[model samples]
Target: MIRRNVLLLGLGAVLATTFPALALDRALTPEETQLIQQIGAHNSAIRTMAGRFLQVDSQGGRTEGTFFLERPNKVRFRYNPPSREEIISVGRGFYVINRKDQTQYAYPQDRIPLRNFLGDKIDLLTANIVDVTSSDAYMAVTISDDTPIGVVQVGLIFDKQTLDLAQWTLTEPSGAELTFSLYDIQKDVQIPKSYFYIDPTYKAVQPK
Candidate 1:
């Protein structure tokens, strides 16, 4: 369950969307390079974002949730009913709260795969991009980063026309995959600071 939660919030992003692997050392075309910059610019322009998300695990378990994000560090995911789970990052670290059992597991924000996506300025070129692909509808970039568990691959997809982030996928070292897609996303909206707040007094168990 702990590992699942780690991937849920740590490795979250889209279903089985696959693209042929591109050599990591290959040079990026000028168009692809420009697209990556545009995506980064689009991301940097957003101060806050709120949306509904659909999370699907490798086993096909589906979960719906509402998410809130504030630039540079904070984000929250409140899963729907039957899921007494919430993942919150209050800048410094991430806490996976299991409301049913009143248990909370904490991990350093920098230690999770989501750290790259939640940065103040998202520069795809600065990331360890392993793959890049584009079509009329979508542009995707896959980034590889190391975490405590192991190296994890994060695939980010954007709408080609708008360059807005559409979905993402995270592949764990153990071969488990988790996907997340956002909808009804409102950018640069006012999200209460309290939404990112995590209770300091709550006892948190650190993942081993």
Candidate 2:
């Protein structure tokens, strides 16, 4: 099994009251509201996408990978050499597979923060949006939700001018954070269904 510290995908959690949904620290500005809506609509328009990603955890460990996404709940992340890990979600389930050991970990799609953004439609305005912040370069919307483990937060950051998703961050209840960024994205492209397939014979394991 993959080590928890290595992937830090301890995403299953229940809301622990540390991050309240819709209980914003402050109100959103008129412009901020408009931009948030536009961002939501822009992402909702993407039916399929392929891209390269860079993932960095709080400890500074970095991993580069290629990812494919099909709307309404399907995605595959294949890490580059030396890392035999792939995270695939086909409809209702998320699977983390270790190629080296043929070991797998499973999770329900709804229990993950990715569910909020991967659906056929994205509505930040109606989601458990806890905070919205912006800078000259990017606009960020932070969303919180309950999981079996504890409260988990995911932040989506979009390019300020283009309204395109640039990166996202996930924070575990234990305060470990992982930042994932996208590049060379090709939107509306066709990807094979086999890419999201889970090996039926892979050994199943629980999250560490």
Count clashing residue pairs per candidate: 6, 6
Candidate 1 lDDT at 159 equals 91
Residue pairs clashing in model 1 are 13-168, 13-179, 13-180, 14-168, 14-179, 14-180
Candidate no. 2 TM-score = 0.87
Q: Among these predicted structures, which one has the highest TM-score?
A: 1
Give candidate 1 regions above 4 Å deviation: 1-3, 6-23
Cα error of candidate 1 at position 57, Å: 1.2
The 10-residue segment with the lowest total lDDT in model 2: 8-17
Candidate 2: where is the Cα deviation over 4 Å?
A: 1-22
CA displacement after TM-score superposition, residue 31 of candidate 2 (Å): 1.9
Cα-lDDT of candidate 2: 0.76
Over the stretch 1-208, how does candidate 2's per-residue lDDT look in tens digits?
2233323232211123244454677878899989988887988899999999888777788888899989988888898888898888887777888888999987776777677778889878887778777779888778877665677687778888888888877777787677788899999998987898898999999876
